[model samples]
Target: MKKAAIFDMDGTLVANSPVHIRAFEIFCARYGVTDWREKLANGFGMGNDDIMRLVMPEEVIREKGLAALADEKEAIYREIYAPDIRPVEGLKELLERLRAAGIPCAVGSSGCKANVDFVLDSCAIRPYFDAAISGDMVSRCKPDPEIYLTAAAALGVSPADCVIFEDARAGFEAARRAGAGRIVALTTTLPREELEREPQADRIIDSFADIDDIGALLA
Candidate 1:
Protein backbone atom coordinates (compact mmCIF):
# COMPACT_ATOMS: atom_id res chain seq x y z
CA MET A 1 0.00 0.00 0.00
CA LYS A 2 2.58 2.56 -1.10
CA LYS A 3 1.77 5.83 0.65
CA ALA A 4 3.25 9.17 -0.31
CA ALA A 5 3.27 12.73 0.98
CA ILE A 6 3.00 15.54 -1.54
CA PHE A 7 3.57 19.23 -0.80
CA ASP A 8 3.03 22.53 -2.54
CA MET A 9 6.12 24.73 -2.64
CA ASP A 10 5.35 28.43 -2.44
CA GLY A 11 2.84 29.17 0.27
CA THR A 12 2.76 25.68 1.68
CA LEU A 13 6.46 25.13 2.20
CA VAL A 14 7.77 28.69 2.21
CA ALA A 15 6.05 31.97 3.10
CA ASN A 16 6.56 33.99 -0.10
CA SER A 17 3.20 35.38 -1.19
CA PRO A 18 4.17 38.86 -0.01
CA VAL A 19 7.40 38.64 -1.97
CA HIS A 20 5.58 37.32 -5.05
CA ILE A 21 3.06 40.16 -4.86
CA ARG A 22 5.88 42.68 -4.55
CA ALA A 23 7.64 41.19 -7.54
CA PHE A 24 4.48 41.43 -9.63
CA GLU A 25 4.10 45.06 -8.63
CA ILE A 26 7.67 45.74 -9.76
CA PHE A 27 7.15 43.88 -13.02
CA CYS A 28 3.91 45.74 -13.74
CA ALA A 29 5.54 49.08 -12.98
CA ARG A 30 8.40 48.33 -15.34
CA TYR A 31 5.95 47.26 -18.05
CA GLY A 32 3.52 50.19 -17.56
CA VAL A 33 0.74 47.95 -16.32
CA THR A 34 -1.67 48.96 -13.56
CA ASP A 35 -3.60 47.13 -10.84
CA TRP A 36 -1.02 44.35 -10.67
CA ARG A 37 -1.63 43.55 -7.04
CA GLU A 38 -5.28 42.83 -7.68
CA LYS A 39 -4.33 40.61 -10.60
CA LEU A 40 -1.85 38.71 -8.44
CA ALA A 41 -4.42 38.24 -5.72
CA ASN A 42 -7.03 37.04 -8.21
CA GLY A 43 -4.57 34.67 -9.85
CA PHE A 44 -3.12 33.31 -6.63
CA GLY A 45 -2.31 29.58 -6.65
CA MET A 46 -2.00 29.56 -10.48
CA GLY A 47 1.07 29.19 -12.64
CA ASN A 48 3.03 32.27 -13.77
CA ASP A 49 1.93 31.86 -17.39
CA ASP A 50 -1.70 31.76 -16.37
CA ILE A 51 -1.29 34.77 -14.10
CA MET A 52 0.54 36.74 -16.82
CA ARG A 53 -2.24 36.11 -19.30
CA LEU A 54 -4.68 37.74 -16.89
CA VAL A 55 -2.54 40.79 -16.04
CA MET A 56 -0.36 41.40 -19.11
CA PRO A 57 -1.58 42.84 -22.37
CA GLU A 58 -1.47 40.80 -25.59
CA GLU A 59 0.96 43.29 -27.13
CA VAL A 60 3.20 43.14 -24.08
CA ILE A 61 3.26 39.36 -24.14
CA ARG A 62 4.00 39.45 -27.85
CA GLU A 63 6.77 41.95 -27.34
CA LYS A 64 8.53 40.47 -24.31
CA GLY A 65 7.38 36.92 -25.08
CA LEU A 66 5.49 34.84 -22.53
CA ALA A 67 8.49 32.81 -21.44
CA ALA A 68 10.71 35.86 -21.13
CA LEU A 69 8.15 37.80 -19.13
CA ALA A 70 7.65 34.87 -16.79
CA ASP A 71 11.38 34.48 -16.39
CA GLU A 72 11.87 38.17 -15.60
CA LYS A 73 9.08 38.25 -13.01
CA GLU A 74 10.31 35.07 -11.37
CA ALA A 75 13.85 36.46 -11.32
CA ILE A 76 12.61 39.50 -9.48
CA TYR A 77 10.69 37.28 -7.08
CA ARG A 78 13.75 35.12 -6.42
CA GLU A 79 15.97 38.11 -5.78
CA ILE A 80 13.58 39.64 -3.30
CA TYR A 81 12.74 36.34 -1.64
CA ALA A 82 16.13 34.68 -1.61
CA PRO A 83 17.40 36.29 1.56
CA ASP A 84 14.29 35.29 3.45
CA ILE A 85 14.11 31.73 2.19
CA ARG A 86 13.44 29.40 5.08
CA PRO A 87 11.18 26.44 5.64
CA VAL A 88 7.84 26.82 7.34
CA GLU A 89 7.93 26.18 11.10
CA GLY A 90 8.85 22.60 11.88
CA LEU A 91 9.16 21.76 8.16
CA LYS A 92 12.69 20.37 8.39
CA GLU A 93 12.00 18.24 11.41
CA LEU A 94 8.79 17.01 9.85
CA LEU A 95 10.54 16.02 6.65
CA GLU A 96 13.24 14.19 8.53
CA ARG A 97 10.64 12.35 10.56
CA LEU A 98 8.72 11.40 7.48
CA ARG A 99 11.86 10.14 5.80
CA ALA A 100 12.83 8.16 8.87
CA ALA A 101 9.42 6.56 8.71
CA GLY A 102 10.06 5.58 5.07
CA ILE A 103 7.31 7.80 3.76
CA PRO A 104 8.37 8.97 0.32
CA CYS A 105 7.67 12.65 -0.24
CA ALA A 106 7.33 14.76 -3.35
CA VAL A 107 6.79 18.42 -4.12
CA GLY A 108 4.02 19.32 -6.58
CA SER A 109 4.08 23.02 -7.25
CA SER A 110 2.51 25.56 -9.59
CA GLY A 111 5.82 27.43 -9.56
CA CYS A 112 8.29 27.06 -12.38
CA LYS A 113 11.28 24.78 -12.07
CA ALA A 114 13.60 27.69 -11.36
CA ASN A 115 11.52 29.01 -8.49
CA VAL A 116 10.92 25.53 -7.14
CA ASP A 117 14.60 24.73 -7.26
CA PHE A 118 15.49 27.99 -5.57
CA VAL A 119 13.08 27.34 -2.73
CA LEU A 120 14.04 23.74 -2.22
CA ASP A 121 17.77 24.33 -2.51
CA SER A 122 17.85 27.52 -0.46
CA CYS A 123 15.75 25.95 2.26
CA ALA A 124 18.00 22.85 2.23
CA ILE A 125 15.04 20.49 1.97
CA ARG A 126 15.56 19.23 -1.56
CA PRO A 127 17.24 16.04 -0.41
CA TYR A 128 14.15 14.99 1.52
CA PHE A 129 11.92 14.74 -1.53
CA ASP A 130 12.03 11.67 -3.74
CA ALA A 131 10.47 13.51 -6.68
CA ALA A 132 9.49 17.01 -7.74
CA ILE A 133 6.80 18.02 -10.22
CA SER A 134 6.68 21.65 -11.25
CA GLY A 135 4.31 23.77 -13.35
CA ASP A 136 6.52 23.23 -16.37
CA MET A 137 6.13 19.47 -15.99
CA VAL A 138 2.33 19.60 -16.13
CA SER A 139 0.10 20.82 -18.94
CA ARG A 140 -2.63 21.68 -16.43
CA CYS A 141 -2.12 23.39 -13.08
CA LYS A 142 -3.90 23.16 -9.77
CA PRO A 143 -7.66 22.78 -9.51
CA ASP A 144 -7.16 20.47 -12.50
CA PRO A 145 -5.41 17.77 -10.41
CA GLU A 146 -2.73 17.14 -13.04
CA ILE A 147 0.18 18.29 -10.88
CA TYR A 148 -0.91 16.25 -7.87
CA LEU A 149 -1.66 13.24 -10.02
CA THR A 150 1.75 13.54 -11.65
CA ALA A 151 3.47 13.72 -8.29
CA ALA A 152 1.68 10.63 -7.09
CA ALA A 153 2.62 8.79 -10.24
CA ALA A 154 6.24 9.92 -10.06
CA LEU A 155 6.45 8.58 -6.52
CA GLY A 156 5.07 5.23 -7.71
CA VAL A 157 2.03 5.61 -5.50
CA SER A 158 -1.64 5.55 -6.26
CA PRO A 159 -3.60 8.80 -6.05
CA ALA A 160 -5.68 7.20 -3.35
CA ASP A 161 -2.52 6.39 -1.35
CA CYS A 162 -1.10 9.89 -1.38
CA VAL A 163 -1.67 12.66 1.16
CA ILE A 164 -1.49 16.20 -0.18
CA PHE A 165 -0.40 19.15 1.93
CA GLU A 166 -1.69 22.41 0.54
CA ASP A 167 -2.10 26.04 1.55
CA ALA A 168 -4.56 27.45 -0.97
CA ARG A 169 -8.17 26.77 -1.89
CA ALA A 170 -7.23 25.71 -5.39
CA GLY A 171 -4.66 23.23 -4.07
CA PHE A 172 -7.16 21.72 -1.66
CA GLU A 173 -9.66 21.35 -4.47
CA ALA A 174 -6.98 19.79 -6.66
CA ALA A 175 -6.19 17.17 -4.05
CA ARG A 176 -9.86 16.36 -3.74
CA ARG A 177 -10.25 15.99 -7.50
CA ALA A 178 -7.11 13.85 -7.59
CA GLY A 179 -8.79 11.42 -5.21
CA ALA A 180 -5.94 11.79 -2.69
CA GLY A 181 -6.24 9.74 0.47
CA ARG A 182 -6.02 12.84 2.64
CA ILE A 183 -5.88 16.57 2.08
CA VAL A 184 -4.08 18.39 4.88
CA ALA A 185 -4.61 22.13 4.82
CA LEU A 186 -1.70 24.22 5.99
CA THR A 187 -2.46 27.64 7.42
CA THR A 188 0.76 29.19 6.16
CA THR A 189 -1.11 31.10 3.45
CA LEU A 190 -4.69 31.23 4.70
CA PRO A 191 -6.21 31.69 8.09
CA ARG A 192 -7.33 28.58 9.92
CA GLU A 193 -10.90 29.82 9.90
CA GLU A 194 -10.86 30.13 6.15
CA LEU A 195 -9.11 26.79 5.58
CA GLU A 196 -11.57 25.03 7.87
CA ARG A 197 -14.33 25.97 5.48
CA GLU A 198 -12.72 23.93 2.70
CA PRO A 199 -14.66 20.69 2.46
CA GLN A 200 -11.77 18.96 0.73
CA ALA A 201 -9.46 19.42 3.71
CA ASP A 202 -9.62 16.27 5.80
CA ARG A 203 -7.27 17.88 8.34
CA ILE A 204 -6.29 21.51 8.95
CA ILE A 205 -2.98 22.25 10.65
CA ASP A 206 -1.12 25.45 11.37
CA SER A 207 2.28 23.85 10.93
CA PHE A 208 3.88 20.44 10.51
CA ALA A 209 4.65 20.53 14.22
CA ASP A 210 0.94 20.31 14.90
CA ILE A 211 0.90 16.87 13.41
CA ASP A 212 2.31 14.55 16.04
CA ASP A 213 2.20 11.34 14.06
CA ILE A 214 3.01 11.27 10.36
CA GLY A 215 2.52 7.50 10.26
CA ALA A 216 -0.95 7.88 11.67
CA LEU A 217 -1.87 10.39 8.99
CA LEU A 218 -0.55 8.05 6.29
CA ALA A 219 -2.46 5.17 7.75
Candidate 2:
Protein backbone atom coordinates (compact mmCIF):
# COMPACT_ATOMS: atom_id res chain seq x y z
CA MET A 1 0.00 0.00 0.00
CA LYS A 2 1.13 3.56 -0.56
CA LYS A 3 1.94 5.01 2.85
CA ALA A 4 1.64 8.74 3.23
CA ALA A 5 0.48 11.45 5.62
CA ILE A 6 -1.29 14.73 4.89
CA PHE A 7 -1.29 17.62 7.33
CA ASP A 8 -3.36 20.75 7.85
CA MET A 9 -1.31 23.93 7.75
CA ASP A 10 -2.54 26.68 10.08
CA GLY A 11 -3.31 25.47 13.57
CA THR A 12 -2.15 21.94 12.88
CA LEU A 13 1.43 22.74 11.89
CA VAL A 14 1.86 26.45 12.53
CA ALA A 15 1.02 28.57 15.57
CA ASN A 16 -1.08 31.19 13.81
CA SER A 17 -4.70 30.22 14.34
CA PRO A 18 -5.12 32.86 17.02
CA VAL A 19 -3.34 35.39 14.87
CA HIS A 20 -5.72 34.67 12.03
CA ILE A 21 -8.64 35.08 14.44
CA ARG A 22 -7.34 38.44 15.56
CA ALA A 23 -6.77 39.54 12.01
CA PHE A 24 -10.27 38.48 11.11
CA GLU A 25 -11.63 40.56 13.95
CA ILE A 26 -9.71 43.57 12.71
CA PHE A 27 -10.67 42.86 9.12
CA CYS A 28 -14.36 42.62 9.87
CA ALA A 29 -14.36 45.79 11.92
CA ARG A 30 -13.15 47.75 8.91
CA TYR A 31 -16.37 46.88 7.07
CA GLY A 32 -18.52 47.51 10.15
CA VAL A 33 -19.19 43.79 10.44
CA THR A 34 -19.64 43.35 14.13
CA ASP A 35 -19.72 39.93 15.89
CA TRP A 36 -16.86 38.66 13.75
CA ARG A 37 -15.24 37.17 16.82
CA GLU A 38 -18.25 34.96 17.49
CA LYS A 39 -18.56 34.27 13.81
CA LEU A 40 -14.99 33.04 13.80
CA ALA A 41 -15.61 30.71 16.71
CA ASN A 42 -18.61 29.29 14.88
CA GLY A 43 -16.68 28.87 11.66
CA PHE A 44 -13.72 27.42 13.50
CA GLY A 45 -12.36 25.34 10.66
CA MET A 46 -14.10 26.90 7.68
CA GLY A 47 -12.37 28.06 4.47
CA ASN A 48 -12.10 31.71 3.45
CA ASP A 49 -14.92 31.59 0.90
CA ASP A 50 -17.23 29.98 3.40
CA ILE A 51 -16.25 32.54 6.03
CA MET A 52 -17.02 35.39 3.67
CA ARG A 53 -20.35 33.91 2.79
CA LEU A 54 -21.26 33.62 6.44
CA VAL A 55 -20.08 37.08 7.49
CA MET A 56 -21.68 38.95 4.65
CA PRO A 57 -24.90 38.36 2.78
CA GLU A 58 -24.57 37.88 -0.97
CA GLU A 59 -26.52 41.07 -1.68
CA VAL A 60 -24.54 43.09 0.83
CA ILE A 61 -21.27 41.62 -0.42
CA ARG A 62 -22.00 42.63 -3.99
CA GLU A 63 -22.99 46.09 -2.92
CA LYS A 64 -19.87 46.58 -0.79
CA GLY A 65 -17.13 45.00 -2.89
CA LEU A 66 -16.60 42.20 -0.37
CA ALA A 67 -14.16 40.38 -2.62
CA ALA A 68 -11.80 43.29 -2.42
CA LEU A 69 -12.41 43.43 1.30
CA ALA A 70 -11.44 39.78 1.62
CA ASP A 71 -8.21 40.45 -0.22
CA GLU A 72 -7.49 43.30 2.16
CA LYS A 73 -8.17 41.07 5.18
CA GLU A 74 -5.81 38.41 3.93
CA ALA A 75 -3.19 41.04 3.22
CA ILE A 76 -3.42 42.27 6.79
CA TYR A 77 -3.26 38.72 8.11
CA ARG A 78 -0.19 37.97 6.02
CA GLU A 79 1.59 41.17 6.96
CA ILE A 80 0.99 40.79 10.68
CA TYR A 81 1.42 37.06 11.13
CA ALA A 82 3.64 35.67 8.35
CA PRO A 83 6.89 37.04 9.68
CA ASP A 84 6.45 35.29 13.03
CA ILE A 85 5.17 32.01 11.66
CA ARG A 86 6.82 28.87 13.00
CA PRO A 87 6.12 25.19 13.11
CA VAL A 88 4.39 23.49 16.00
CA GLU A 89 6.48 21.55 18.48
CA GLY A 90 7.64 18.11 17.31
CA LEU A 91 6.63 18.88 13.71
CA LYS A 92 10.21 18.56 12.52
CA GLU A 93 10.61 15.31 14.39
CA LEU A 94 7.45 13.89 12.87
CA LEU A 95 8.52 14.92 9.38
CA GLU A 96 11.95 13.37 9.87
CA ARG A 97 10.40 10.14 11.00
CA LEU A 98 8.11 10.01 8.01
CA ARG A 99 11.04 10.73 5.66
CA ALA A 100 13.21 8.03 7.26
CA ALA A 101 10.41 5.56 6.80
CA GLY A 102 10.09 6.54 3.15
CA ILE A 103 6.53 7.68 3.79
CA PRO A 104 5.68 10.61 1.58
CA CYS A 105 3.91 13.58 3.16
CA ALA A 106 1.96 16.46 1.71
CA VAL A 107 0.31 19.54 3.14
CA GLY A 108 -3.45 19.66 2.66
CA SER A 109 -4.52 23.06 3.83
CA SER A 110 -7.53 25.35 3.51
CA GLY A 111 -5.29 28.37 3.20
CA CYS A 112 -4.14 29.66 -0.18
CA LYS A 113 -0.77 28.61 -1.61
CA ALA A 114 0.82 31.98 -0.89
CA ASN A 115 -0.10 31.72 2.77
CA VAL A 116 1.16 28.17 2.94
CA ASP A 117 4.42 29.07 1.23
CA PHE A 118 5.02 32.07 3.45
CA VAL A 119 4.58 30.12 6.69
CA LEU A 120 6.56 27.07 5.58
CA ASP A 121 9.39 29.15 4.19
CA SER A 122 9.50 31.37 7.25
CA CYS A 123 9.67 28.35 9.50
CA ALA A 124 12.48 26.93 7.31
CA ILE A 125 10.50 23.71 7.04
CA ARG A 126 9.41 23.79 3.43
CA PRO A 127 12.08 21.26 2.51
CA TYR A 128 10.35 18.55 4.54
CA PHE A 129 7.05 18.42 2.68
CA ASP A 130 6.88 16.25 -0.42
CA ALA A 131 4.13 18.41 -1.87
CA ALA A 132 1.40 20.87 -0.94
CA ILE A 133 -2.18 21.35 -2.10
CA SER A 134 -4.12 24.37 -0.96
CA GLY A 135 -7.83 25.25 -0.88
CA ASP A 136 -7.31 27.52 -3.89
CA MET A 137 -6.01 24.53 -5.83
CA VAL A 138 -9.32 22.74 -5.59
CA SER A 139 -12.91 23.44 -6.52
CA ARG A 140 -13.82 23.14 -2.84
CA CYS A 141 -11.86 23.28 0.39
CA LYS A 142 -12.07 21.41 3.73
CA PRO A 143 -15.28 19.61 4.65
CA ASP A 144 -15.47 18.96 0.90
CA PRO A 145 -12.43 16.63 0.55
CA GLU A 146 -11.02 18.21 -2.63
CA ILE A 147 -7.82 19.53 -1.10
CA TYR A 148 -6.98 16.28 0.68
CA LEU A 149 -7.67 14.30 -2.43
CA THR A 150 -5.50 16.68 -4.41
CA ALA A 151 -2.70 16.36 -1.87
CA ALA A 152 -2.82 12.58 -2.01
CA ALA A 153 -2.79 12.71 -5.80
CA ALA A 154 0.17 15.08 -5.81
CA LEU A 155 2.14 12.76 -3.54
CA GLY A 156 1.25 9.69 -5.62
CA VAL A 157 -0.59 8.09 -2.75
CA SER A 158 -3.99 6.48 -2.62
CA PRO A 159 -6.46 8.27 -0.35
CA ALA A 160 -7.27 4.99 1.36
CA ASP A 161 -3.65 4.53 2.31
CA CYS A 162 -3.03 8.04 3.52
CA VAL A 163 -2.98 9.23 7.11
CA ILE A 164 -4.26 12.72 7.81
CA PHE A 165 -3.28 15.09 10.59
CA GLU A 166 -5.81 17.78 11.19
CA ASP A 167 -6.80 20.26 13.88
CA ALA A 168 -10.32 21.22 13.06
CA ARG A 169 -13.68 19.50 12.63
CA ALA A 170 -13.87 20.57 8.98
CA GLY A 171 -10.48 18.99 8.28
CA PHE A 172 -11.48 15.83 10.08
CA GLU A 173 -14.61 15.57 7.98
CA ALA A 174 -12.65 16.29 4.81
CA ALA A 175 -10.14 13.56 5.59
CA ARG A 176 -12.91 11.07 6.13
CA ARG A 177 -14.66 12.14 2.95
CA ALA A 178 -11.36 11.72 1.12
CA GLY A 179 -11.27 8.13 2.46
CA ALA A 180 -8.17 8.50 4.55
CA GLY A 181 -7.15 5.26 6.22
CA ARG A 182 -6.21 7.00 9.44
CA ILE A 183 -6.69 10.42 10.98
CA VAL A 184 -4.73 12.02 13.79
CA ALA A 185 -6.71 14.93 15.06
CA LEU A 186 -5.03 17.58 17.15
CA THR A 187 -7.12 19.38 19.74
CA THR A 188 -5.86 22.80 18.84
CA THR A 189 -9.00 24.75 18.11
CA LEU A 190 -11.72 22.44 19.29
CA PRO A 191 -12.37 21.10 22.74
CA ARG A 192 -12.02 17.42 23.66
CA GLU A 193 -15.73 16.79 23.51
CA GLU A 194 -16.06 18.39 20.11
CA LEU A 195 -13.16 16.43 18.67
CA GLU A 196 -14.46 13.21 20.17
CA ARG A 197 -17.73 13.80 18.40
CA GLU A 198 -15.93 13.54 15.08
CA PRO A 199 -16.29 9.91 14.05
CA GLN A 200 -13.51 10.26 11.48
CA ALA A 201 -10.69 10.73 13.94
CA ASP A 202 -8.69 7.59 14.61
CA ARG A 203 -6.64 9.30 17.28
CA ILE A 204 -6.88 12.56 19.20
CA ILE A 205 -3.99 14.50 20.65
CA ASP A 206 -3.34 17.88 22.21
CA SER A 207 -0.40 18.50 19.97
CA PHE A 208 2.36 16.66 18.09
CA ALA A 209 4.36 16.83 21.29
CA ASP A 210 1.59 15.00 23.09
CA ILE A 211 1.83 12.01 20.82
CA ASP A 212 3.86 9.41 22.64
CA ASP A 213 4.66 7.26 19.61
CA ILE A 214 3.36 8.80 16.43
CA GLY A 215 4.95 6.13 14.24
CA ALA A 216 3.15 3.47 16.18
CA LEU A 217 -0.08 5.36 15.84
CA LEU A 218 0.36 5.53 12.07
CA ALA A 219 0.97 1.81 11.94
Q: Quick one: best TM-score, which candidate?
A: 1
Query: Any idea what lDDT model 2 has?
Result: 0.81
Residue 211 accuracy (lDDT) in model 1: 87
Error of 2 at 145 (Å): 0.9
1-219 per-residue lDDT for model 2 (tens digits): 448888899788886778888888788777777867776765656677787877765775787674566677778998998667778888888888778888888999988777888878888888889898877778887889989989999988789989889988788888888999889888777787888988888888887777667567667
* Candidate 1 C-alpha lDDT tens digits along 1-219: 437899998888987878888898898999889867766776777887888998999999999888999999999999988877888898999999889988999999999999889988999999999999999999998778999999998999888998889988778878888999988888877888987778889988888889897667888
Which lDDT value does model 1 have at 46? Answer: 83
Runs in model 2 deviating more than 4 A are 57-60, 64-66
Q: Stretches of candidate 1 above 4 Å error? A: none
